[model samples]
Target: MQHSYRQLADLLSKEIRAGRYQVGERLPSVRSYAETHHFSVSTVIRCYRYMESQGLVEARNKSGMFVADWKIQNASADKTTQGKKQPAPPSVEYDKLISLQHRMTELYSLTAQPLHLGLHLASAAPQWYPCEALSKIAQRQLRQQPWQIGDYPTGTGLPALKTGLISWLATCGIDLEPADLLITNGSTEALNVALRAVAQPGDAIIVESPVYFGLLQMIENLGLKAIEIPCVPGAGISLEALEYALEHQTSVRAVVAMPNFQNPLGCAMPEKNKKRLLRLVEQYDLALIEDDVFGDLSHQQERPLAIKAWDKSGRVIYCGSCSKSLAPAFRIGWIAGGRYQSRINSLKLSSSLITPLFEQAVLAEYMQSGALPSHLRKLRERLVANIPLAIAAIQRYFPAGTQVVSPAGGWWLWLELPEHIDSLALLRQAVGKGIAFTPGTLFSSSSKFSHFLRMNIGRPWGREMEQGIKTLGKLAAELHV
Candidate 1:
């Protein structure tokens, strides 16, 4: 009961600090707030009282609460404007890429523990998924097809799952048939196949600066070079910079992008930029690997459209998965390989033969059951509410000059700490304190983002999660130079 009120208080506190309510502005009445959030009136009263104690709001005589003239406790706005001027694309350094791979391996081995607060991985807690529904579907599938367990995967994917994915992709404004889609182990495999379909050893692939570390590892493992283009916060890759790189980097064969809710930065590309990207790719005659794994988890009423949605030239190799949205353990991801469908299918066959049949069958049934939309809706709400809580904790605890990017959608919170605070060193200290987060060094081929870090707020916001953030902030402050 107490925790419930505190959660409300914390959320409101974040809003207040974000300038949603101005000084001396009247706040919603306790009763109104309670009714809107479905909290008890008593809980709302307690919340208001707590805020009053914290100097965030003040109670008026016989009137409602008002915003107090309190100093905003959150991190100040970032000094560096994100999208104002396009910087030249950074050269892809081979030595830096090798260092990234080694550092990532070390970090993963260190954080692979049951008790670690793993805010590094871009996945949500299991409770956020419809596990009971999926389990029931799996049980029904196995009972109906008893011999499925002993069977090997026959082709690229189960037909039923592909059919279901067709309907699901339509929701994201991407129109494709099952013939165009190939299922893989997850987005990881889907991206790998997509990259292999377009580029080979020594080929240069364009990637967002401070991109997902896994993508860097893939580039390194495949012996491909990356041309790092900068991305704007809350928006995606810079079209101007990308065009510049395409013009200069003659060996570039493919451009990999997460147009919607990019990992770490949590940015999406605008529709105009997406269309322009398609045009650019057609002009360059290079493939575009669109990773839309985070597309379905929109925090807004209308979901953002993917670059694949506007593709006409078939240059866009679309990749997505249920890993982030529906199921993690199932590892069900698909690719609409566009012009490279045949190549991707061949690669898929030679690699895994097929994605697991049972899990695909289970997901197919679950999707058709009309549960995914509601499940995603509830999951998005949880993420929306949880983001601010983490940000508020960061503001209250971290040292001054810390800047956090509050993305419109997705579970990540990208933070820029004091310039001298090495996030990797902070991660080491945080691990000692039973917390884990992604050091921004892993995100880039260069050490440009050594002061940055990414946090996953997909877990349920609670005392423990807040404590983890607090510990990370303390560690960051101690390392602040």
Candidate 2:
């Protein structure tokens, strides 16, 4: 077979396996595919016809070629014959099944617009990112492997990067061996892998009320039920409420939490509460998924200890990422699965092979050179300066009754608006004024946080941001009427 046709066929097969070309799913149009690939239209038509002859696809008039149902049946049979089980039949439409994708799209679209006070900002301004450092590392990598352009990182991820993580964690009082760590795309993938390793569908899980919206979406995506516990703003999750949920909800399989600089709220659990939560985990025989993505972005230089430090029984699954300190595009994160290391590693293999190797290698180099710590120090200083500016802006512009929590660390400030003013409606109005903030309704399944909004204070507090807050406050005042 010619290389062109073979390459196209391979691409089609990979999509089919990945379920993007699901059974009976329509393939891209010949003209579109040809234009995308920069190939002649005849070549594209030939590929489709070849697929049809092999019974891998079918054509429909006025529509397009679709993946043949027999292709899936054949694949299923091949799996069975090879002693591999086929995936379960999907219970919902693929688009409907992944709720986070939709929410993320909405968030991204909002940011893509030319906005002044986009409160959904997750990291620092792009100018603050270490792009030059990353570029240098990437260039060096290409120079060394001039001919090797295609290489997939195995599920284990880059060895040097994993070692770097182990060394870095040790500095924070987390003494995990390299074998205990599994690198993932980000903390999001780490959470998904940990959840799959420990829990099943319909299993009850303990989550903080007004928890991380992304985590809530993940829980819903996995078909798990969340038993929400009331959590204090300054003080992490309510230990008493957590204990009650654990004691009463025997079906609870895991407790997902962010012990330090938690998302949206920026609350760090006290040292005493961290110890108590670990004890409860052991007593209830549950898994603890600790998301610490924002841990390194603390305003204070004195790093608070991670929950994993108190995990003697190996039930804690500690997850962290450099998305805040470094950059979100890096997508390099890891999970330290105390005792369930191998299971999480296996799950990583089954999901995506691994993160991009070149990026990991560059990150490892950056960490070894102490660039990471230096960058983090600067980031912390900037955040510490920005936080007060944000609070002052809020106080000056927000309604008189509006309440705000001054977090000891992290870059987010949670606002408690008046009960009658819906945050979702406020968000719509804010966006119209070129402002964006996370509506509290996205934080929980119950939608009980209708009057709250999570503001990102990571960006510099300038005239644009200050003006945006004033506009948001004006909108809030209108809603009050």
Q: Which candidate has the highest lDDT of all? A: 1
Task: Locate the minimum summed-lDDT window of 10 residues in model 1.
Answer: 86-95
Off by over 4 Å in 2: 1-112
- Which lDDT values do the candidates have, in the order given? 0.83, 0.78
lDDT of 1 by residue, 101-179 (tens): 6677657866875556888877899999999999987888778988999987787789988888888788778898878
Per-residue error for 370 in candidate 1, Å, reads 0.4
TM values, all candidates: 0.79, 0.77
The positional error of residue 405 in candidate 2, measured at the CA in angstroms, is 1.0
lDDT of 2 by residue, 1-481 (tens): 5668667877887777788878888878766777888876556655776766666777553256778776565787777867533332111111122244454554566568888666787777876778888888779878997543586556477888888888888877898766888888988899999988898999988888778877877888898887888888677899998987777787899999888887778888899999999998998889999988888877677788998987888999999997877867888889998878889988888778767777788888887888888888888898899887888888898887899888878888899998867776677567777889887767766546768899887776678878878888898888775
